[model samples]
Target: MPTPKAPVRGRFAPTPSGRLHLGNASTALLAWLQIRSAGGTMLLRMEDLDRARCKPAYSASLIEDMHWLGLDWDEGPDVGGEYGPYVQSERGAFYREAILRLQRDGWLYSCYCSRAELLLMANAPHGLEQEGNPRRCGCLYLSPEEQETRAEEKTPSLHFAMPDREIFFADGVAGARSFPSAGDFAVQRADGIIGYQLAVVVDDIAMGVTDVFRGWDLLDSTPRQLALFDALGAEPPRYAHGPLWLGEDGKRLSKRHGSVALSELREQGVASERIVGLIAWATGLIPEPEPCKPQDLIGQWTPGRIAQEAIVLPGNWMDRLR
Candidate 1:
């Protein structure tokens, strides 16, 4: 972690592919609170990289939901700051430049594997960094003749060459962590879209983000992002992955959890304060599930206070708000 005096720039980036569910809103509240309590700059970014699935309507609705929950940001798509184009789809030029620089440094290579071939290659043995660690894809490293033939056939995905070394970083919430080096990963897909791994790192670096607070589900992805940050020669933000809100059945809380979406809650005339208050209580931010706003919890925000274990909420957890 940087010195306490260092400027803290944090962001809440949400993909505009779906409605903001309780899980999403709760995470956002935690992220907003973490940054706000530190008196840091908080940014909202629309991670609409997959343009085909992400819609402007969803983005607008998400902003509305956040506003309803009393969350505010200093920089975002609505309120432009130094980082003008906060939406991922508009940041292709930056990603392309990074790709060029990586290619020049021989840190990127072409991947021509088709969908079926890629699926079969999933089980292919990887160069292990340690026993029982997660493994990513190995480099294709095709010869000149094979490359020429593939170029004529289709556009190849540009993949970052993973350096065979362990990546270790301290998480503000999860504590000391380490991930074994695995296989190469794509920076750009064959369909001509900027890959998630590359875009996330590039966006955070460009926005001068100093802290990253997200859900526990994305904890494993930190190393891959850290690797990209290193390859791109940028200082990575400190990451903190908060516990997830899972269903009572021990599965991730998702669309299957009926009427838990912020939009649905609003449609049912549920007060935003009620939702925020219940989340604050469930996540161990408050002793009681009393009505409150995002700002109300900022004063009591603490890394230790956020629930550590996956919070298993029952199917009718939304009833409390009603």
Candidate 2:
């Protein structure tokens, strides 16, 4: 008999900026299925660093949606595991320590450029406008005196000085991936909140996440994240970015695009199994759409079996539910 492999540690980190939408639900379902199918541990982490937008109600709703869909997590904010405080807002001390380490190791630099300034500079002729260019602002190579002067005028965000080289990694779904460059990205914002790139890398490391399943919209961010994992001396997790869910008009799914939020669907008497079934069919895990729970599709789930291209919903998809 062959020796069994150790169970993979996977996570589904969602931001509580809004109610769970169809896109969010599909991603959550896929992540849950991947972890559960492999007999791996699944964790839920709330990416609620943006306190100004995140709310307890939103988090509650998200948890409710997951439960309704039968996506049970082994560790999460509701259930304290070895890794307690699964919420990002509660993990500030960890982020602070990591930031200090990066600074001590000379991986972090002070960035004084505002969003507007960076946008204008990026659009300027002969400016550092190319994709993944670190010299996005004059402050990238500023002297101590110059940094001090800028600091006096505006609070500086911390940026990771990205190495100018090709980064390579293989995705479970997207296959071999390579990025020619990784632009210097922010680690901490001027408003004092840690940036998503840094926070996610730190959280994944601390939580022992071995695999990550997310939408392909975040594929380009892999290289920068890999650099952070390297600088922090933590092994990066394997990534599988699936196709995004698009509206019938072939545009990204959003409220404006008629994408139904889970809450609204629940109010409309839509069963959770119906939602999961629709997602499963859309992702190529099922021959056709039929009311089914997430568990029912696990036996049929294979990461590579998922479509690499975006799945466009029917114009009257919501009408069918009604």
Candidate 3:
């Protein structure tokens, strides 16, 4: 019998709070390019764990938008994989186990500070942002008695205790990066919610992810993740920070600036091919050519060709999509 091949895995995870936007579509395309170029398998996961905001319509639209764009996932919520239950919301027990493991290892503690209290402390005149051991909040200093008393009064949040050293890591796309990541960061909220830092760390480790391609906006969050990986004795995955697309004002593209969702763009008569072409142009996968379909562009797409600098979208590009 032939030996089983080790699957090369890449994933696209979108929250179901809204339809996918241009920026998000671009990201999905880039990730697809990377996975395709590697001849690897790609997966999709709905980051719809936030029950208060998640909408079924939005989730359906996300899948529909990806289908319109011709992006396919080899494994996901729709199709079962060895890693079933791809949605974070469905993996509650996994997170619970991770939290328990961290707690037993003395890597995490329970915090009981309210949001207002934390804000007041953070905004104090003498507030400090320490490097490796950045003073996040003084809540870490609370004695066991105080913690128990607070626990009896209400619920306590969980925090990951960071070490005192500069965290540095090599980026696959952006190159060597280092940052000061001090401060006791929250792992679980007082409302029994797991923070991104904690959730992503546990998920990546569990999924055996080898690479991570995300926007430059999340570059700052890398150090904290690195710290978590170190604390858990897990190897960090290869990292890449793709260039972010901005508006003419040079700010990040957001809904406030008329940055509609990807599905909305489709509804407004924007062709999926043009949207892919725009991303290719902006990311330097292919320079601005006259016009082309998404399939034609993907055939020549290369993830390594993405530029490091953020590209601002042109107004006429939207018109071209029409």
Top-TM-score candidate index: 2
Each prediction's number of clashing residue pairs: 0, 0, 4
Query: What tens digits encode model 3's per-residue C-alpha lDDT throughout 1-322?
Result: 1211446667787888877877788778887777776778777877776788998788888899899888998888888677757788888887888888889998887777787877776565543543334455655678988877888977888888887677888886788888764567788888887787877877777776666778778888898898888887887777878888887778877776574577668777877777777778777877674355555665676556778888787656576565
Judge candidate 1 at residue 255 and give its lDDT.
72
Model 2 poorest 10 in a row by lDDT: 1-10
Q: Give the TM-score of candidate 3.
A: 0.89
lDDT of 3 at 12: 82
Order of candidate numbers by lDDT, starting with the best: 2, 1, 3
Candidate lDDT (C-alpha), each: 0.85, 0.87, 0.76
Better of 1 and 2 by TM-score: 2
Model 1 pairs whose backbones collide? none
Candidate number that wins on TM-score, 2 or 3: 2
- Candidate 2: where is the Cα deviation over 4 Å? 1-6, 123-135, 319-322
Alpha-carbon runs more than 4 Å astray in model 3: 1-7, 120-132, 289-304
CA lDDT, candidate 3, residue 75:
80
Model 1 ranges with Cα > 4 A deviation: 1-6, 124-140
Clashes of 2: 0
Instruction: Give the better candidate number (1 or 3) by lDDT.
Output: 1
